[model samples]
Target: MTTAPAGPDPTMQAIGQAIAEGRAGDTTSARQKLLSLWSVIGATGDPLHRCSLAHWLADLYDDPAQALAWDVRALDAADAVTDQRVQEHHAGLHIAGFYPSLHLNLADNYRRLGSFEAATEHINAARTHAPSLPQDSYGDLLRGAIQEVAEAIALRDRSRRASAPGSTA
Candidate 1:
């Protein structure tokens, strides 16, 4: 196998800069820089940096599919490098998904792909990973979301059943 180049990765730094700039004009450059960083970080001898870069790359990508793929990679990298902080944060983030979080992202992806079953599965997965399950407003909100997904799946199933031949109403 061909050996990867050894050095400090300027590409990741460039990606961080471009991302911070937040100019629509810099999106293309930012994406390219992030991709390049992802390629070299694996060989650069730092799993934390690799996981951080992967997380940033996933956040930088606007497309849901692309984001999902990158986030999955970030999670893998975090696990590979044994980032306990990332692991703990990941568990919380998946549940407290109030904003730009992974749980919402994965749920939206499954929804877009028309996999309500998978969407519900992810919602439950998020709940399981939740750091706290206290009976508070936040917990209620989480429960509501899970219930909504469940109801939606039930509705979808009922509709499908109705459309089947000789189905009783």
Candidate 2:
């Protein structure tokens, strides 16, 4: 039920700076800044803000389990976004366009956690939605990343089965 601010929030600018810091290898500073912003944004803030914050926060965690929790929060927040809100927050971007990347992140997190079943489920979801993404360089990059993750999961599953007890290979 939370509504987005009428205009861009200054805090979002700080969050962007934090993201830049993270990209520049200052993850510790980035995380600290993001944590501070999260405190201001609160748990019940605008869905777009929550989704973006949670998605970025997930990358700051080294543990896949913790990252998965943040990814889940991001997805849940994304689900709450209305079309009107999407127009307000992201202009041309639709909520549906976010799903493929979210699923890919979830799949990667699940794979790192050794939950192959969950990983495959999200990987399939990512593939299902990949075509709906904008046909641009970013979309192409995401598609390639999705394929790479899928291959990694397949390789991991194969190794897992080969090492399992009573394997007939």
> Using lDDT as the measure, which candidate wins?
2
The pairs that clash in candidate 1 are none
So what's the TM-score on candidate 2? 0.84
**For residues 35-135, what per-residue lDDT tens digits would candidate 1 score against the true structure?**
76666666454655665566566555555566668666655554555434333433323212332233533554465456777766665665564444446
Residue 71 in model 1: shift from native, Å? 1.9
Per-candidate local distance difference test = 0.50, 0.78
Per the 3 Å backbone cut-off, how many clashing residue pairs does candidate 2 have? 0
Q: Please name the candidate that would achieve the greatest TM-score relative to the true structure.
A: 2
- Model 1: how far is 114 from its true place, Å? 2.0
- Count of clashes, each model: 0, 0
TM-score per candidate, chains pooled: 0.51, 0.84
Pairs that collide in candidate 2 are none
lDDT of 2 by residue, 1-169 (tens): 1354456767667778888888777778888888888898888898888888888888877777877898998899989988788777646667888899889889888987888899999999999999878888878878887888898898874222221111121
